[model samples]
Target: MERGFRLILAASLMLMLLDLCRGSTIGVCYGRNADDLPTPDKAAQLVQQHNIKYVRIYDSNIQVFKAFANTGIELMIGIPNSDLLPFAQFQSNADSWLKNNILPYYPSTKITYITVGAEATEVNSTSLVVPAMQNVFTALRKAGLHKKIKVSTTHSLGVLSRSFPPSAGAFNSSFASFLKPLLIFLAENKSPFMVDIYPYYAFRDSPNNVSLDYALFESSSEVIDPNTGLLYTNMFDAQIDALYFALAALNFRTIKIMVTETGWPSKGSPKETAATPDNAQTYNTNLIRHVINDTGTPAKPGEELDVYIFSLFNENRKPGLDSERNWGLFYPDKTSVYNLDFSGRGSVDVITGANITNTNGTTWCIASSNASDRVLQSALDWACGPGNVDCSPIQPSQPCYEPDTLVSHASYAFNSFYQQNGASDVACSFGGLGVRVDKNPSYDKCLYMTTGSNKTLSTNATAIPTTSHSLAGKVHTSKSSWTFMISFLLFLAIDSIRGW
Candidate 1:
């Protein structure tokens, strides 16, 4: 009996760890500043379809809160700048606002963070931010949700006076009074300091100094900060570390940072040549990959960071440059502006025409031509075993078993694992043995699995188990650790059954 109980406990722990490991750190800012945008329900569905798990909105719309209820997607809702004075002065007002806009839908809505006033410094309302945040915190405390739903305000990068050499980063003295108290509030409450980091603006302002490649996270060259001797690879990290240094300077290094907004516009005025669909795709794609991979900044290597991509849909009402209205991943019609894998594993193909049903373009993974048979076989074994790829279709007497070559077998398994994992670039990279191809490699009766397709076949050419291959690609495991845990669990189950 004791042994059986122990086995059950071990299984439970493994399941919990698996749950913790399977989620995306990337989120999208669901800004509805356009009349053409889809309804809140439709928007929520769209977010889920792409496997995106987090969302940040500009306001606490009850409709949005209701639409997202029980969706399991976490939300970071905002309290608008205009409401700051009232929320700041009156705890009753904050409490009423929360009770009406938040409490009714929360726990079901999965609302996590409450951002009070976005970029208050930019709006010249910095004075109201901290007080508003305090009142909101008080309201949450009264409702016994102070710990669950954190309160913070978003700041623009303009808060920093010097962000060049990341090590020498410091907040502007003009905003010192506002920042000091704000940082203290955040540290005391164990909340994150939310900031909007826009590399696009930097590149736009100084095209000569800021390399486009650096902003897009595709730079091969490194920028070494002379002061700290820290090597910076991309502008995103440098920008983030700048804030990190600033926080440390204020002796508030304990406060975690969350990227409240970041994205590139798909379209811009003629003068804003850098804003294009291609650049936007590359920037957001690489941004997702960077955050999900946990490749932290030079100052904080491998630290977990949560980021939200700006503007889920193009907002026609947003003021300023033409680019201001075009920073959207999707059109109001719910079609993708361009292909993007929120899973951070692979590239997405650009969507065209009215065919919005299949957003995942024709992409496949195959054994690399340069890879040796030994390497192919090794990868095949890993994919079939530890990789959790469904390999029954590649067995003898199966449709895919005919060619019988190591490459052929490896290709089938690699594609299965790749497609199962949202057709990500990293998923197909079986230790550099697998490669992604645009052309479909399916020949004869062996139908290969592609992203957004559920036609996995076996010897009988019938559909195999597909429950594991969710659109979100939530299940993730390391090569060795996952295998060991699974094997141990299996052993435990068998032993427990026998003992019973």
Candidate 2:
């Protein structure tokens, strides 16, 4: 009996460890800025159908709060800039707001976070941010709900005066007065520093320098941060690392960073060639996979970072460029803008590759940007040796050797093997370290071999086609990917760059 009991305890402990390794559910922001959106109840139902457990609304809409009641969905309510002054001057106002907007819907609605203001530092409402946050916290504490719901605010990436090289990221000197007190309050309260990170904006503003693949999380080329010697494959990780460095500079290293907004627009004005349904689908799908994989940024490896995708439905009335109103994953009628699985619990799906315009006979397979060096090396060894692929092209004297990093070399060899073996998923995936692309990976003098025939590649073992919006007969067999994977593989935690 004693031995049996001990075995049961050990099994339970193992299960707990597995649970910790699971990927976190992805969250979405619900901004009701459009006139044609579905009703609150309909939106809540749509969220539930998508298996999304987290949602954030821009304001404390009573209808939205009531809609989420008993839905088991975790919510984050926003306090707009308009309420900042009132909440800052009088804690009583905050108390009243919470009483009317929060307390009544408490446990049933699952309010997990309350954002005091959005883009406070960049907007004119900078002065009231800290005071407003403090007042809200005080009100929550008085009502005995402070411990239940976290109080925080979101800032735009514009808060950083210097973001290049990531390690040099720092808040603007002009905003120092506002940030110093805000950081202190956040540190004391154990609230996360929320920031809106948009790589699309960066790419659109300066397409000459930023690699489109890097911004879209589809790049095999690694951007090494010179100061930290850390490898960054995607702009999202680079952006977060910049914020991490900025926080460390402020002596607030322990304050966790949460992504309040990060997404790609499906439509944009003429100049914004990068924004399209294909690009949006690619960026967001890869993002979901990255999050579920549990791979933290290069700065903070193995850490679970909470993230919320920009908006739920496209807001037709939003101002700015065309892309501004097209960030939503869903249309106004509750239909998905593109095929996406937030839980990341599906087969390995590959959207548009390097070129979305023309994908026919040619296909290129390369190393997954998300995989670690150790994993890439293991796969690289197999691809060069027993995989029966030509790797001499990646040697020191060869052209592909210029940017000769582990990631670059491995990608070349992996593609060689993939092209040689029919470009099938099984041929490319050297222990899950390969990704098949439809575009050429060759550049300059380094020529990657590609499949010339127009033979249709078998999709039997690859991802299922998920473009359809009608879910009348579809079935889900696997567990939620968010609840199973450990971390993303893009940002590997190099031993040398661990503490920097």
Candidate 3:
């Protein structure tokens, strides 16, 4: 019995280790924008109970930080936007903030990065983010914690005036002044430009324009960007690239951007009555997929964007929009809000190890994002194929994407969007039509980003047809000299006619 017990124990340990490794990634943003909720200690337990290994919070709540200590739950803490001016003014305050909130509870608490602000450039946010981030960096350095901890801020999707085609990325020129400096900081510090992008919002706000299939991450909704002529089945990538377009326009194309806060509210106020349980599950299902399966964006193929979903539990105390308090994976009572599974993740059956590699929602985000092929390809065949989105938005004179093939038609609809308010080259290297990923890898050269990284395409010229025999060898090596001479004469005649 003792030997059997030992064997079982050893087996269990190995399994637990594997589970932990898998779950190490894929985090949940634990936003406490509300005043009421569970205490830090209890909340920490609640997070663990769900087997989520990563947590992102808006403020460096001591209780929350302390609660997660030694739990191996990676954390991302933040500073309020209002504090930006103060921290920038006094590095001492930063030092004090760290000493009081960070230093003492660091390694034990697994405090990872320090977000300067939560979507600082987003709606209703102050414009002092750039200065605040600068101050935060300086203070972190003085405290000797800059290297160990990253300093950055987040923004809202609204930062981009337009986002449709993945290729035509650009930012709102109005926000450009503040965004330019912020992008530089992120690039310099090796930090990510965070954005709070919600496809649900797009769907709700522009229901007539945004397709449900696209927002829901369903397989059928086929969206094509005209600028690059790349096809997109979902809206998440489109939203991210809009930020990319904005950054690229400002000449900050190299900066790596991430989604800091994104999610669909399970419930909503009477005005936002459209919020439903099913939609929430679908949004999360697809969102989790893009994060885990490493689906590349239409602009940057193969490059995976880091994402943090908003909130672990519903905050009854949250104010304002009803949706504000509904973006939780769980309720305050420690029960799951919905039954959507990421990577089919759930602890109900047996709580042993982390199963976190975020399988594309066993039910949600399953289109080009991966694993789940739930999209009914036949159903969406038409919308994504050709002549779908009514182009009352783009003016007639604008040189837009022409409906060619199924791929070209949809890609063009989105590609013509001028967020950065300009265009460079419009060449179709592949048959002079279809999507083209800039093949350059070096810094000076901008490879047209297409959902790929480290050799996105498996092989080049796959579609081009060619004969094995060399034309020159075949013509010149002909056994009959007379025939070769005649061929050469014909070639010369043809060249002369072409004015060669």
Candidate 4:
């Protein structure tokens, strides 16, 4: 019984630690392909208000990087498709570009990863990206930032040979020549595979064949991956598992996959119809809920799946169909393109206008709550991206084995029971106070926890708390008790994981 109790206690702490290391920030792609958009400075303010910590952009935009500097946001930089050939051909250019574009504004701006190309495989310049990526990696190694800044390229799902029934997922034969080598590189360097997944596109192409409810994430129509005998209720999750299954089939289970882009367009053209603000809002809103709540898909149950919504704002100048230019939740002026409430994580809705600005407090709270750990850990996890898993909502599959919170606790040497240590309290703190916690409109009270220390939590402790550490570890130590504290520190130094 004592051993069992110890096991339970250790498991609880591990759960708390895992939760502690997670990030709530929504990773949004900031495409500056259009000329008409907020200046990077104003954009930064909008981003800061939303508390977005991860921002991925095409090309190393100095203005964009500068705008985000010191805002405490992490960036995934990019090398444009146009720069690939030159970068590949001229090693010096890659080095020079890094010095000129990347070095000057990184530590302060927090450039985490450099995406070599956006949706590389399906694009016209597909052949060039692989070599260009090599050049960038080589440049990074030369510049001594290779270890600090991850090297990766995002791909469109167009490269997938088969995505349906998810387990049957296979990479296109054409990409195998490029992909196998790329996978080896990714595995070698510990970089993630980024892909832009849009279930809306699949539905748009074959609405008659696809079920709208499943695409919309309405809990009715269920999806199943036949190969794995796993059920996927929504297409977004099925799409993700499909990639995993495909990669696994290729003998690569460890390569982390990130949804570099996944979102719905709020507007569209006649021939490319199906875009509407409501549908876009529903898609994005549901997606946001799925991620923030640490919801998981059927294949990787309970594993938070990291995903980045397609865009920060609409790019008016994108060269494509109307839908291409319309996949934004906000207009160019920073105004929200739709009306929605994130259960009080701050509301997103604005009248259509050219120069409007929207600030999202709730989103930022959720995002930063995870990033605001000890700087060293954030510095590590924030390298290019998060654990890269944003759990989905509505329990897409049977829950996987719950993480060994007990082992985690013992591993960290946490000397407290979950209830005594306030584990649930910490978990529940993710709502209100401008933080986005997934909610069902039917219930007034959401997932909550009783506090440790028998301290009566301030009524507003969960939302608008008096201090950030009401639940999590708050006090480090104090002055005046110098000798006693010194003795404790010495005792703990040996036991703490950082030291151990």
The C-alpha local distance difference test score for the whole of candidate 4 amounts to 0.60
As for candidate 1, its clashing pairs are 345-424, 345-425, 346-424, 346-425
Q: Provide the TM-score for each candidate, comma-separated.
A: 0.74, 0.70, 0.63, 0.68
lDDT of 4 by residue, 370-449 (tens): 33334323222221122121122112231211332222212111111111222333321212111222221111221122
Candidate 1 lDDT over residue span 287-384, tens digit each: 87787666778999866677888978999998999999999998999998987765554522222122123223567889987887655666676677
Residue 394 alpha-carbon offset, candidate 3, angstroms: 60
Q: In angstroms, how far off is 243's CA in candidate 4? A: 0.7
**Best lDDT among the predictions, by candidate number:** 1
Model 1: lDDT equals 0.79
If both were scored by lDDT, which would come out higher, candidate 3 or candidate 4? 4
Report, for every candidate in turn, its global Cα lDDT versus the true structure: 0.79, 0.75, 0.57, 0.60
Q: What's the best-to-worst order under lDDT?
A: 1, 2, 4, 3
> Model 3 TM-score?
0.63
Off by over 4 Å in 4: 1-20, 23-25, 271-273, 340-500
Error of 2 at 195 (Å): 0.5
Q: What is the C-alpha RMSD of each candidate to the true structure, in Å?
A: 9.4, 14.7, 23.4, 13.7
Q: In what order do the candidates fall by TM-score, top score first?
A: 1, 2, 4, 3
Q: Which wins on lDDT, candidate 2 or candidate 3?
A: 2
Clashing pairs in 2: 23-482, 293-487, 293-488, 294-486, 294-487, 294-488, 295-487, 295-488, 370-489, 370-490
